[model samples]
Target: MPQNIYVDSYTLESLSNDQNVCNACRHLYIKWKNENSELSSILDHFKNDMYELMNVQVQTEDSPRLTTEENPTLITTTNHQVVKLQLNAASSFHTKCCVCVENLRDHAAKITSQNRDFIFFSRNIWIPEGARCCSGHLINQLLLKEAVDQIKPFSIRYQELSSSDVQLLLNKAQNFVENGKKIFSFDDPRDLNDDEYRLLTRVSRDNFNDFVQTSSTIRPSCSRSIRTAVGIYLCKLRLGFGYVTHQYVIGRHTTAIARELMCGGDSTDTTIIIIDRTHLHIQKSRNNKFERKTFNLCKKRSLLKSMMIITTIGYVVACIGSFMFNFNNNDAGITKDILLRNTSNILSWLKEHDILAVDRGFRDSICVMEALGLEATIPSFLDGRRQFSAEEANESRCITKIRWVVEVANRCLKQFKYFANTIQNSSLVYLESDVNCLRSHQSLSTTYDKI
Candidate 1:
């Protein structure tokens, strides 16, 4: 008569029904039954109540599943929910167009003929006339206005043409006009040499003097021997040549050329110097021992021996050659040299107090200016570090503004065809030198007049 110890009331009921149960639970139940047989009947009743509670269920009736056609409204409701969710997501993520600053999709929708034409003529799209951009962008109104203003003069000139001039021009105009097409011909004129026609056909005013000097029957020799020196100095200044090139072309050595340009008499008002540099490649020499050899052995044997020796020599030479010829080798000390030579005079000319605005390439030159009691301004290098100081940032902007003048000067100098392309002949050396002097003088004179 063992009393059952029930871990759960359900286990007790299973045991009473003679159903198999876990050994651990059954063992515990048997021990309790032996210890307390009176409690076994109470446990059995408790088990019956627990089983009834666990097994209790409410009545549920099955409903028929709805078919697609029978529940059309439900289908539409689900579709609408999905569409709404997508629309909300899209609206949340919508971004403005970079060019127009308008909603990109809305802009896109307005790109049709009716909408596009209205915006195009109204100039409301805020884009350049020829510019292609989405609707939302604010057109570059200032840039468009500037461009139109620039071409406005030409347009006015076109409109100002007399009816007779227009008719004459129209008659001369080429048939079948297409994009990027140009027509150039002498206009119909009563006089054989009209001033306009001559001006059109003749060399430009800037180049007129140079052209005349080159083609003139009378060679304009220097009035004085000193004039030749002056001319040569001006030429060197204008044609941005080094001591070597100037010496070779001017029939003077490097020291002479340097002295004449640097220490010579005061640079004339007409003196224009354009200074720039180019790398000159120097080749490594072959081994003397390998280059000369006595031929005494068999042809094949000698050839093999020579090849081995030559290959070894070639490898060594190439290594040395690369080390010597590499641009980095020359670039190392060049900035220092240029700064020392050029900036000294330039700073002195600026009266040692005026700002020396220069580009990034002239960073080292700034140090030279500092030594000369001059302040140099240049753009800050974008080295991916912290922001530049206010002073440094302003200096950069100032330098950029002034640097445009130098750019214009360079462009003007390049207008000379001789300097526009690479110098090919010895004559170009003199021509280049002259051009530099002329440009420097022009720029200095212009600057001085402004001051």
Candidate 2:
């Protein structure tokens, strides 16, 4: 023990009576007595006294009205040990808004975990649970940039954090940095203006808000918020990504809808379905058999054909059978295969006297359609003649008018680059599903222009 050391009367009295001392002094005493540690109780007591002295000074120098309110305890750390904070500003309480410092009994906008994270990432402030802010300061439960800028620690505050807390903060920081690299941020209205939202999502801000509200049941995942998930979906649709989902399937009621739309047409009680074949170019496969099978003699290229069945109103009924470009898989043969296979229950949907209006390529399937109690309307082929006679010309022109919608439907499907550009052999497996899903979208959507 050092000479000329002074001890406070409270500590001396406690020691003389062997009463419980302060935690720091008690810990030091235990270490010294049990293990002959070099730590001294007097020094421990001295540090505690200094911390109390600082608290006293802060209380005296600050506003007198502070005495009326409960003093908030702030936990701090020093030299890897827990210690009391000696800050000048009053720490915020759970019952008050940290931004305006107003007491909120109820009707407060509690700071959400996401808003708390954003505040920490932007301002290095850790808002405790149950802390709140004025609702005006937040847009979509996210702090505005101005609100984030306005936030500051009343004074320097050191917080003692465990390893898990440190790890959580690190993860938030990493996510913040990762999110910063995004070109468009939909969660923060400040990050994306109204016009920007409309440009990217093809919806105005108010409409987007309504969409988010309506889709609130789409629960947020660990990696994304509900708003962000909805925004991603909209962005994907607007950009023509057309990601496949469970809802992309052709529903059973699709035929009924097609029948309804095709009924009551001019001068004919028979249901009319326009059929056309569109070819998608593909790379010449390395395999000799596949390359030959996909070679189109007319276009002199490797190609794959998809048969489109659509309504007169340009609503695609079904996109089926991405067949090879070989003669056996010509438009007419593909039509016959569809009819024979009864794909999508085509036979059940078509009634007797139903009209299948198609171009010249489907002439071979005319007999198959007639046998199925269906009528196949094809334009008159030139057949070694320069042009059609007067009666043939008028009839062919009439058929052309009805057949034009299928061509427009094909063009609309090709608007997506996945169908318009040359496809790789690796993507052949997804061709049928992809085409059906895209056409299904066209059928369900009323936004697209109709011919």
RMSD of each predicted structure: 33.2, 20.1
**After superposition, which runs of candidate 2 have C-alpha atoms over 4 Å from their true positions?**
1-269, 383-386, 443-451
Query: Residue-wise lDDT of candidate 2 within 1-451, one digit each (tens)?
Result: 1111112221332122123356676564444334322223323434554444434434444546544234433223211333333222323676766777777655668778887777655555667667777787777777766667666676565554432243344345445666776755677765866666775677887788788889857988789888789887775564211322112222321233334433433423456678888888888899999999999777989998888877655666677878998879988999999999988677777778877878887788899999999877777888899978998887777777556667667777788877888898898998887777545343423422332
Q: Please give the clash total of every predicted structure, in order.
A: 26, 0
Give the Cα lDDT of each candidate.
Answer: 0.32, 0.63
Q: Runs in model 1 with CA error above 4 Å?
A: 1-335, 338-350, 386-391, 425-432, 444-451
List TM-scores for all candidates, in order.
Answer: 0.27, 0.47
lDDT score at residue 29, model 1, on the 0-100 scale: 56
TM-score of predicted structure 2: 0.47
230, model 2: CA deviation in Å? Answer: 11
Pick the lDDT winner.
2
